[model samples]
Target: MESTNNIIEIKIDSYDDLVNHIKGKTDKCGDLRDNFIFRGLSNFEHELVPSALRKDNLNQPIVNDYVGGDLGLLVLISNEDVKSNFLEDRVHIDLGYGKWVSFDKNQHPFFDNNREYLKNKNYLQIKRETYALLKFLNIADKNGLKINTSYETRSKIHNYLNPDKITFWPKKSFFEIISLAQHYNLPTCALDWTYDYHVALYFAVKDILENKNNDGVIWALNYRLFEDNYNESNEYKLRFYRPEYHSNPNLRAQKGLFTFLINPVDEILDCPLDQVICREIKNIGKKNKKTVFDNGKDLILIPPEITENDIIFYKFVISKNAKLDILEELYKEGYSEDTLFPGYGRVIQNMGNRVMLENIKNESDKKPKKNILLKIKNCEDIFQRKINYLFGKFNFNSEIENIYIYSPESQEIKGYFKANEIIKNSPNLIWEKYHNKSNWLKKDFNNYFKDNKAYAIRINGLIEFNFPFKINNLSMGNQFMYIEPDNTDINFLLNFK
Candidate 1:
C-alpha cells in the first residue's frame, strides 16, 4: 500500500492501477483526494506534476523540493500596488556550521503565498544559510570572505566569497549570480509575486540565469506569470510558452505564453472569482454581519488602480430593519452629489446611510444571509474610486478600534469604546440600529431627523447621525463648506436650516 505522502511526491506510471487505488482511497476518507491540486495525478490517468524549484527559507533547507511528502510547501509574497521596503536585490550566503550570512540590511523576503515561515525572514541568517548551501554544493568556497557584515552602500560579493574562485563569475547584473547557480545545476526558486513590469524585468533576469533547458520562459502575454507586457529579450532575455496549463500537451511548448492570473488560493471559493458579493452595504455602526476593510470610516484600498472610464458597480443588500441613515452617510461620502441615484426606488426604511436592506428578521435564535440586494455602479476612475470603496465596505467583520466620530456640535467628552455610540445625543433626532454590527469595535452613529429616521455622523467613515442624512460636500480636513449648486434640489438641501 503506497502512502498518501508518496502521492504528493513522485507519480506512478500506471493509469488504470492508479485510478482503482485512488477510487478505493476516496471511498474511505470522504473523497479527500479530489480536493488536492494534483487530483488527476492521483488517478494515474495523469502524468507528473512538474517540480517547482527548491526553497530557501531559514531553518528550512534551500534544496527542499516544493513537491515533497503529503503537501508541497508553497511560498507566496504579497503583490500589491503599495511598494514594499523589503523587496530588493539581496545576496544570501551560508558560512557552514549554522553561521548563515546575508548582504541585505534591514530587508525581508516577500513571499506572496502562504509559505511555511516563508512570510517571515531574518535577512542575515537567510544569506548565511543560502551561502552555506552554495558552499556545501561546492558552488562557492568557504575561504576568507567577509562572513557576517552589513553594507549600507553597494559592495561586492567578493567581500564574502572569494570572487577569484568560481566557474561562473559574478557580474554587473544580479541575474548573473542566480545564473551562476544554474550553471552549477543548483535548483533555485524564488517567491512568485505579481511582477509589475519593473519587477518582472528583474525576475526575468534571474530566471534566465538559472533556467537552462530552454523551457521557453517566453510566456504569452495572457499566460500565467506574464503581466502587462512580455518583452522579447532576444539574446540576453528569452521567454517561452510551456504547455502545462493548456488543453493539450502537444500544444504546450508553442502555446504557453506567460500571463497573470488571480493569485492562487488553496480553495477555489476563496478567490471570489469576479463575483464580489455585497453581503451587506451599510454605515460603520450597522449589524448586517459583513466584513469591514481598513481601520474604519470608509473602506480604503491603498494604491487602487485608477483608470479613466473604469466603471465601479456596487450592489448593497440590507435587511428591512437595518439602519438607513448609515447608508445615506456612506452614499454621501462615497459619491459626490453629481453621482446619479437613477431609478425611482424611494426610501422605504432608513437607518444612517445603510437603509433597511433585504428583510428584517426578528431577534431570532438563528442567523441567515440577507435577502435584499441593491446595486450601484460608479463610472470614472479617480473622480470617485467607488469600486475600491464598496469592495472595502463589504469587509465589515473585523471592527476598527481607534475610529472616532467627532461631533462638532457636541461639547461633551465622547471617547473611544469598543461598542459604538453617538457622541452624546442629538437635540432633535432619534437614533436607530445600523448595519454596522459586522464592525463592532468602531463607534457607529445613526441619528434620525424624524422619529423613525436614522442618520449616522461621519468623521472618516464613522456614521454620526441617525438619519441617512447627506451632509453637504465637505473636504476631509476642511471645516467650512459652501454649496453653490446649479439646481433647485441642491439649493434646498444647502439652506434647509
Candidate 2:
C-alpha cells in the first residue's frame, strides 16, 4: 500500500483481501459480503461491517484508515490500474485535413466542403460555426428547450442571433441535439456515467470472464469531493459539466448521466499521449519542441486527475479468481447487460457474457449432455426474441419437447405447450404477464415484452418454428441462459440432424 497526492492505493492479492481490509476498518459484525453504506471520510468506524476487526482492534495503520478521514474511495475494480484521466471520454473525431482528435474545449471545431478548421488556428471558420451553433441553441431556448444559458456570454450570443434576422429555427433543444449526436457515435466530449455502481461493475468486468488471464476494475469516484476541489479558488483547475438528461431510452436504461469537459487545455497539456499517437507526437515534438502541429495547432487534453493521487478518487483491482464471484453477485443483484443496456444490441452482448460466465459456473458438471438446455432465467423482451429465433431455426416442436413459460413477476405459469401446440394454437401460449392476446401473432409481438419482468425458457428448439423478426434482435436485453439442465421437468428438444 502506498499514498501519493492524498490518494491511497491498497494493493490486495485477491478479492477476499479487499473485503477483509474493508472489514478491518469498521466495527460492525457479519459477513464481509453484506451491503454497507460507503459514506464520507468522517467516522467510518460505526458504519464499517465485520465488527470483529474494527479500527480500534486493527494492529496496523493502513489504507483503510483513510476511509474515516477527509479521503473518499473511488474504487476501480479492474485487473489492471487504469491510466486514463478522469475527463477522457475515450472518443476520437475526424477533424479534417487528415487530423482526427478528441474534443478540446480550448478550441472550436468546424469544417467546410473543401477543408476543416480548428478554432486556435482558423478563427474565421470557428467563429462562423460557433455563431451558428449558438444561434440554434438560442432558438431552442426560446422554444422552451432547456439550454444552459446562465453564462453571461450567452446574452451576447442571443443578441447576435437577433430574432428579426431569423427566418426559420429548429425546434429540438440543445440537449436533444447533443444526445442524438452522442447516440450516433459522433465525437462528443460527453463522458457516460451511471447512478448505479453495479452497472459500473458490470461494464468493468463484462469482458473479464472471457479473458481469464487478464484482470478487470471498477472505478468509484466522489464527484462531490471533486467539485469541492475544482471550486476551491475558482482558478479553473478543471472544468466538469453534467448535461441535463432527457427521454433517451438507452441513457435511461443504463441509468446514464453525461459529464462534459470544458477548458481542459492546461490540465492535460503535459500529460502523456495515447501510445499509438505518442510515437507520432514524439517525432513531431522532437523536430519542433514548441509546437507538435503546424502553425501552433495543439490539442486539448483531459483525465489524468482520475488516476492521479487524490482524496476524491479510488479504484479496486479485481483478480481473476475474484472476478466470477463478483460477477455472480452482481447478476443476483440484477446488474446484467439487459438491466444496464435496454436495446437488442446490449442484450446480445450480455448474452455472450452470460454464456461465458455460465460455462465457468458449470465447468465441473458431472454429466454434461451433448446438447445442454439453452435456458434463460428471468427472461426479457430481447430474450424472448432470441428464443423465438432459436425455435425457428431449430424447428422446436411442442410435441417432442416440453416448453415451459412461467411469470416470475406474477409467479404463475403463462402456459406449458408442446411444440406442435404452438403451431396449432399459438394464441393459447401467449404470456399475458407481458404481451396480451392482441399481440400473440402480431408483427411487433416481441416489442411489447416488458424489460426485467422475469420470464424463463428451459427447452431446446428445432429449426422449423416460424418466429417473427430476425434472430439479430434477440441479442438486445438481459440474456442469461445455461446448458446444464435444472430441476424443471421437461424433455429438452433439439434436431439431431
Off by over 4 Å in 1: 1-59, 63-125, 129-158, 161-172, 190-497
Assess candidate 1 and give its lDDT: 0.23
Specify the poorest-scoring 10-residue window by lDDT in model 1. 213-222
In the range 1-497, model 2's lDDT, one tens digit per residue, is 45534333443333334444444431112222222212111111122121111223444212132122211111111222112222222223322332233222222221112322233322221222234445455565679865544454355554542212211111123334444344434323234445555565565555556564545543334455444434222222123333454555556665555433322222222121122122333344234222122223332222233333334333445555446666777777777877765778878887887778888767723333232223223435423544442212122222234443433443322333333222211111233322432224544444433221212233334333333112222221222222235523322322311
For model 2, what is the alpha-carbon lDDT of residue 98?
26
RMSD values for the candidates in order, in angstroms, are 27.7, 23.8
Give the Cα lDDT of each candidate.
0.23, 0.36
TM-score of 2: 0.36
Q: After superposition, how far is residue 415 of candidate 2 from its true place, in Å?
A: 54
List TM-scores for all candidates, in order: 0.18, 0.36
Per-residue alpha-carbon lDDT of candidate 1 for residues 1-497, written as tens digits (9 for 90 to 100): 22221112222112221222233332211221222111111111211111112224553434443112222111233333112424222213322322121222123232323212223232222333234334433323345432222241124433334322221111112232332333233443211212122122122212222222111110101112122233322111112212222332212211112211111122111221112111111221344222132223222111122122221111111111222222233334432112222122412212211322212213221342221111122212212322221111211221123232223333211221131222222211112233332122223322212221222322233222233224243233322112235435434632352
